[model samples]
Target chain A: MTSPTVFAAVGEVGKDFFKERTTDTLPCQSTDKLFCWDWARENFDRYETPLRQHVELVLISVAIGFAIAFALALLSHRHRWLRPPFLLGTGVLYTIPSIAFFFLLLPLTGRGRDTAIIALSAYTLQIIYRNTIIGLDNVSKSAVEAARGIGMTDRQILWKVEIPLARPEIFAGLQIATVSTVAIATLATFARGGGLGEPIFGGELGIDFKTNIIIAGGLAVLLAAAFGLLLLWLQRLVTPWRRVETE
Target chain B: MSGLLSQLPFASIDGAIEFIFEPQYSNVTGGNKVGGIDKVVELTINQLQVTVISLAIALAVALPFALYLGHKHKFETLAIAFGNAGRGIPELALIAFMAAAIGVGLLNVAIALAVLGIPPILTNTFVGIHQVDRAAVDAARGMGMTEFEILRKVEIPLAIPTLMGGIRGATIAIVATATIAPLAGYETLGDFIINENVYGENGVLAGAILVALLALALELALAGIQRLLTSPGLKPRPA
Candidate 1:
C-alpha cells in the first residue's frame, strides 16, 4: 500500500531532518519556544516525515481491518457454524490488551509498523463483525421472501436488497473502527515506527514535560477533529436515506 | 473445555490461585518466569482498583452532565460532539498524555482511563433518560413533582437498562485496555505478558491466556449483573 511506502520513507528521513534543523536552533530556552510559528517553520521539515508516517499507519491498518471484517461478515453469513465461532474468537481477540497483543506479536514479527497494524486490526474485528451481523440481520425478512418470490437468486437478493439495507449499520461500524484505528496507531511509536507519538514518547523519556504535554494534547485535538469530520462525511455518503427518512 | 483447561499450566482454579500466590513454589516448566505469583496477584488487584475507581469517578461526573444535557436542547449538540470526540481519541495516547503531564503512576493511569470512560457513560445516560416515555415524565410533572423529583422517579428508572449496558461495555473496554498501564510503570497483568515477551519466554502465552480468562470472567459477571438489573420490570403489560 502507499501507506506503508509513505511511512517508511518518512521514518527514514525524519531523524536526520530533525537533527539538522532542530538541534541547536532555539530562539528561547523555555518549552513554549517549541510552539512558536517560527520554531514550527524551522522544524516543519522534521515534523512532516512523522506526520506522514502516522497518517499512513492509521490508513493502512483501517483498510486491512475493513477488508478482513467484510470477508468475515460475508463468510459468517454463508455458513451457520462459522458465525458462532468467528464471533466468539473475535470477541476474545477484541478483549485482549492492545499493548500486550503488540508485545506478543513483536517477538515473532519483529518490531515495526506492521505489528501495530495487525494488533489493531484484530481489535477491530469484534465491533465490525457484530455490527455487520446485526446490519445483515436487520434486512427485513419480508424483503428477502419477496425477492425469492420474484425468482431473484440469493446473490441478487444480497447485492440488491440486503446490502443496501445494511449499508448504514455497516458504515456506522466502519466509522467506529476507523477512529479507533487512528487512535491506536499512535502507540506504534513504541516500536520506533514514528508518529505523533514519537514526540510524546520522546518527551516522556527525555523528561521534557512541556514538549510531551503539547504534543499529546495537540495530537488529541487533531485526531478528534479529523475523525469527527471523516465520520460526518461517511454518514452523509452512506446514509443519505437517513436524512430523507427523517425529513 | 475441561480437557483443554487441563492442558494449561495452571489448570484448576486452586492451582491457579496457588500459582498466583506462591510463585516460588510454582514449577517453572517453561523458560519464562516474568515475576513471582505475588507480583501477578498484586498487579491484577492494582488494575482492578484503577478500573473500578476510574469508572466510579466517570459515572459520578458524567451523570449530572448527562442529565443537564438531556434537559437542555442547546447543550445536546455540544454534549454529543464532546462524547464522540472523547471516544475517538486512542486510550493509549490519552494515557501517554496523562503520564507525560502528571508523571507516570496510578493516578495518571486512572485519569486517562476515566477520560476515555466518560463519554460512553455520559452518552448512554443521556440517551436512556431521553428515551423514557415522554408521557410518563409529563405525568410526573403534572402531579406537582419538582424537576429533580421527576428526574429521579420517572427518568432514571427507565434509563437504568441502557445506563447499565453502557457501563458494562465501558467496563469491558477498560479492563482489557488497563493492561497498558504497565507501560507507564504502573503494574498490571500486562507486566507479566510484556516482560515475558521481552525476555523470550513461553510465559507470554500463559500470561495472555490468564488475562483473557480474567476478561471473560469479568464479562460474564457483568452480563449477569445487566440481566438482573434490567429483567424484572421488562415484562410486557397486559392489553
Candidate 2:
C-alpha cells in the first residue's frame, strides 16, 4: 500500500501521507479544486484492486441472487400458490437499505465480503424473481399447446419451451440486477468488503476528496454501463427471435 | 458458541431494542447519555424530510416533462436511456461527491437525492402514459374533449399505476439513500450507523432496525396511495 513514486517529476502527491503541508500548495492539495489531473495521474494505480473487487462483488452477488431467485421462481411456477408469499418475502428483503442491511446482519454474519454478498444478493431477489415469473407467465398458450401435442412432458415443456421463450425477459431482469449491483456494491466497503468505495469513503485521501470521489464514482458508472451492455448483448445472442421481431 | 455469541456487543437483540427506546451511556464522549426514542424520532424525521423533499422535487420536474413526452410519443429512447443511466449512478458516490464538491447541507443532499429520483419517475411516467390505450384517448377526443382535457381525464388516470410505480421506486431510492445522508452533513437515521464510535454496537443495530421499518412503512404507504389513485375501471377483477 505504499504511495506511488513514479510521478516525482510532476508533483509529490504520493509522498505526503496526510502530513501538515508547508506554504507550497498543488492544485490537488486544494480541496475546492474540482479535479486535479496531476493528482489523478499519480493516484490512478490506487483504484486498480478496488475496481477489480467491485466487479467481483457485483458479479458474485448477482450470480448468487439469480440462482436463488431462479429456483424460487421455478418452485412458484409449479405450485402457483407459493407466488404471492415468495413475492412478499423477497419484496421485504428488497425494501431494506444496504447500509442498514450490513449492520442488521453484523451479529450473525459479522463484517466482511460475506455479509456484503448476502445483503447485495438479497436485494436482487425481488426484481429477478418477479421478472422471471412474468416472463414465464407470458409464454404463449399456443406454443405450450403445440409442445403438448408433440407428447412432451411438463418438465420437458418447461425446460425446452417455456424457459427458451422466456429468455428475453429473464435477461431483462438480469440486466437491471447486474447494473444496480454495480452501484450498490460500492457500499460493500462499509462491510469491509473492499471495493472502489474504499477510496471514495476516505481510503487514502478522504471522503471529501473530489478527485477520488469522481474517479471511484466514474468507475462504478462505467462498470454499470459495461455490465448493462454485456447483458444486452448476451440477451440478443440468446434470443435471436427478439431481433427478428424488431426488424 | 454461547461464549462467542455473548462476547459480541450487538448479539443481545434486547440491547438494540433498549438502544431505540432508552438512552444509554456513551463512553466515547466521556460517559455522555446517547440514543433513545427521542433521538431515533429526530433522525427518522430528518430522513423522511429529505426523502419527501427529494421525491417532491423529482415529481415536480420529471412529471411534466415525462407526461409531455409520453403524450407526444417523442424521445422514447432518451427517456429509456435516462432511466438506465439513473440506475447506473452509485448512490454513495453521488452523496459523497455532492458533499465534497457541492458543499454539504440539507438542500444539497436533497438535490443529490432528487437526481436519483428523477429518472425512475420520468421513464415510468413516460412509459405509463405512452402505453395508455389509443382507443380510449380517441374516444375521449371524439367526445369533444380538448387535447389537454383528454390527457387530464383519460391519460393520467390510466397511467396512474405505472406513474405510481415510478413514484414508489423514487420513494424507495430516495429513502434508502437518505439513510446515508449523514455523510453529506445531513443527520438522518444513518448517523447511528455512520458514527458507530459514538453510538456503539447496539445503536448501529437500532439504526438498522429503524431504517428497515421506515422503508417498509413508506413502501406500504405508497402502495395504499397507489390503490387510491388507480381508476376503478382499471382495477383487477377476480378470475
Candidate 3:
C-alpha cells in the first residue's frame, strides 16, 4: 500500500519515464527508439534481476510444495481418514485462482516471497498428493508380501519397496508441478515477490511495451521450456525402469 | 485490511461492498486509472464472456481432433504433447505475446485464454475415448454396427464422465485465469487488482473475493453437471 506513488515510480525510473522515443515521434517505425532492444541491453539489470527472481521463486515454491505434499501423502496413507479431506482441501485450494489466492494472502502475510510461495505451493499439492497416493497404492501386493516374508518391517518395506516403485509417478507429478509453478510465478511481481511481471506490467503501464513485453514473455516461456526438459531428464534418471517398461 | 487505515478513504468491508456494487465514488490518488474498466459487475460479466468465448474456441479446435485420433488409435502423441506444452506456458506470457504481436483487444484475451483451455480438453478427450470399455465396443462392432455408430453409441456414452472432467477442468482454469484479462488491456475482474492503487486496498480485496467466489461456483456447478451426466452404472460410489 505504498499509495501508488508517482514519485517512487519516477525514483526507480527516470522522468522521461515512458519509453521516450516512439514511431510517432520518429520518422519511421524501423528507427523508433521507444522499444529499442539496445535500451533493454543497456538497462539489462532491471529485467535480469526479475527473471532470476522468477526462476528462484518457482524453484523454492516447488521444493516446498513437494515436501508438504509428500508428507501429506504419507500421512494419508497411514491414516485413511486423512486422505479424502486432504485431497478435497487441496482441490479447493487449487481452484482458488492464483491471483485471487495471492491477493487473499496479502492481508494475512502482507506482500513478498512468503505470500507468493504460500499461494504458488498450494497449486502443486493436488497434483503431487494424488500422484504420490496413486504411486504408493499401485505398488504390487506381492512385493510387499515378499518384503514381509523376508522379515522386513512395514516401515522398511514402504521405504525399500513401495517408494522405489512409486518413483516414476511421483516424478511425473513433480514435472507437472514444476511446469505450472514456473508459469504461475510470473504473477509474483504483483504480490511483491518480484518476478518477470515487471515488463509485462510495465508494458501495460505504457512504457517501452513492445521490447519489454517480448523480452519478458520470451524469458518466461524459455524458463518453462528449460524446466520441462530438466525435470523430464531428472524423472528419467530416477525412474530408469520406466524406459524399459514403456519399451 | 490496509484499506481500513485512516490515510485511505475507501477502507472498510462496507466500503468494499459499495465499491464493488457501486463504483461511482472514488478517493484514489492522481485519478490515474488503468484500463478504465470500472464497475465490479461489469468486470465479472466481461470475465465470463472472455472465458465462454475461449472455451468455445478451444473445444472446437481440440475436441474433434482428439475424438478422431482417439477412435483411430493414432497420433495420440499429438494431444499429449499439446497438453504438456500448454501446462508449461503461462497465460501471462501468452497474453503479453498476444498484446505485443497481435495488439490487444477482447479477441487477443480470448486467444490467450484458449491456449490455457485446449490442453486439458485435448488430452482428456483422447483418454476418455480410449478408456471406454473394450468389451462394449467389441460387442457393438460384432453386432454389425458402423464404426461411427459404435463410436457414437458405445464410446461416447461411456467416455462422457471423463470427457466432462476434462471440460470441467478446462472451464475452471480459463475462468480463473480470465481474471488477468485486465493486464492484457481487456476489461476483467483483474481491473480492480491491476489498478488497485486507484481503487484502493478494499477494492482490490473485494475484487479478489468476487473472483474467487466466481471460480468456486463454476467449479461446483461443473462438478454437479459431471455427476449428473455420469451414467448410473458408471458413477463411482461415495467413499
**lDDT value for candidate 1?**
0.67
lDDT tens digits, residue span A1-247, model 2: 1111223411333234333233334656454455666778887999999999998899899999999999999999999999989999999999898888998887888788999999999999999999999999999999999999999999999999999999989999999999888988888888889998888774867788777889999999999999999999999999998889999
Number of clashes in every candidate structure? 0, 0, 1
- Spell out the clash pairs found in candidate 3: B3-B11
Better of 1 and 2 by lDDT: 2
Deviating ranges (above 4 Å) for candidate 1: A1-39, A75-85, A106-110, A140-150, A191-194, A202-208, A220-224, B1-34, B71-76, B135-154, B182-185, B190-213, B233-239
Best candidate, lDDT-wise? 2
Candidate 2 regions exceeding 4 Å error are: A1-27, B1-11
Q: Give TM-scores for every candidate, taking all chains together and pairing residue i with residue i.
A: 0.75, 0.93, 0.86
**Model 3 TM:** 0.86
Q: Which scores greater on DockQ, model 1 or model 2?
A: 2
In order, what DockQ does each candidate have? 0.23, 0.48, 0.32
Q: Candidate 2 lDDT, tens digit per residue, B175-229?
A: 9999889888889999988888898888888888899999999999999999888
**lDDT of model 3, residue B22:** 55
Could you give candidate 1's per-residue lDDT for residues A1-247 as a string of tens digits? 0112333434543453455455554553243222334455555455566677777877777778778988899888878679988888887777666665665554356457787778878988887888888999999999999999999998999889898889887887877777766676666765556666666654333423334435554664586568658767877787677889888
Candidate 1 reaches a DockQ of 0.23
